[model samples]
Target: AQSVAQPEDQVNVAEGNPLTVKCTYSVSGNPYLFWYVQYPNRGLQFLLKYITGDNLVKGSYGFEAEFNKSQTSFHLKKPSALVSDSALYFCAVSQRGTNAGKSTFGDGTTLTVKP
Candidate 1:
């Protein structure tokens, strides 16, 4: 089974500060990892993904994540955060080439960027 974990229910960061959102995964085979952000009452928006290349993958809105196969982790990062960056973030995982349309999502982590 493929699954994702976001240990923290919420993350608080100040504007202009860097932020990190932790994530971990479990899969039977090579994993397709993804990060998505959700605004209030809205659907998820794709942030970034780690499929093949460099373990360090950059994504939308100045966000990035490192795919660590040995650790089974894909932790999201941002060099600097904005108040607008506050949102619900999710870490998702699916087996490579296995109809990723049905990827499993972690319990979302709410990011609060205080101005």
Candidate 2:
């Protein structure tokens, strides 16, 4: 079965420090990976995605992720954290079969940045 696991429920970090939210996935064949952020009660905003090509993919909000095919991991990273960056982060995967458009999301990881 294809699934994503975000090990950390929440991560607390000081503003300006580098931050990372881990994600690992299991699936058959290649997967379309995505990262989204949701603010209080709002819909998720797309952050980044690893479809194909380079291992490091950059996206909005100064965030980037490395796609590790061997370990089957796609971990989100940022060089510097911000207080405003604190929100719920979700890792999603879309399959290549008939359910391509459908995305399965991880439980979510709440990032708390202290100023």
Candidate 3:
């Protein structure tokens, strides 16, 4: 079965410091990995994706992720955390089954950035 795991319920960091939100997945064949950020009452915005090639992928708002195929991990990282960056983050895997539209989301991780 295809699945994802996000062990942290929340991650706290100071503004201007580097931050990371961890994620891990399990899938048959090659999987499409993604990271999304959700603001309060707002739909998730796509941060990045691992489709093919290059382990390192960059995305909107200075966010980036490294797809570790060997470890089955795709962790989101930012060089500097912003107070505005504090929000709910979800790591997802695309399931190309009949539910291709389905993106299995991790139980979101709330990021709190202290000013």
Predicted candidate 2 versus true structure: per-residue lDDT over 1-115, tens digit per residue: 7899999999999999999999999888998999999999899999999999999999998999999999989999999999999999999987777375578899999999999
Candidate 2 ranges beyond 4 A from true positions: none
Model 1 lDDT, full chain set: 0.95
lDDT, candidate 1, 71-111, per-residue tens? 99999999999999999999999987788577999999999
C-alpha lDDT score of every prediction, in listed order: 0.95, 0.93, 0.92
lDDT of 3 by residue, 88-112 (tens): 9999997555375677889989999
Candidate 2 clash pair list: none
**Clash tally for model 1:** 0
Better of 2 and 3 by lDDT: 2
Candidate 3: stretches off by over 4 Å: 96-99
Compared to the true structure, candidate 3 yields what TM-score? 0.94
Pairs with backbone N, CA or C atoms under 3 Å apart (clashes), candidate 1: none
> lDDT rank, highest first?
1, 2, 3
The alpha-carbon lDDT assigned to residue 53 of candidate 3 equals: 94
Task: Give the higher-lDDT candidate: 1 or 3.
Answer: 1
Off by over 4 Å in 1: none
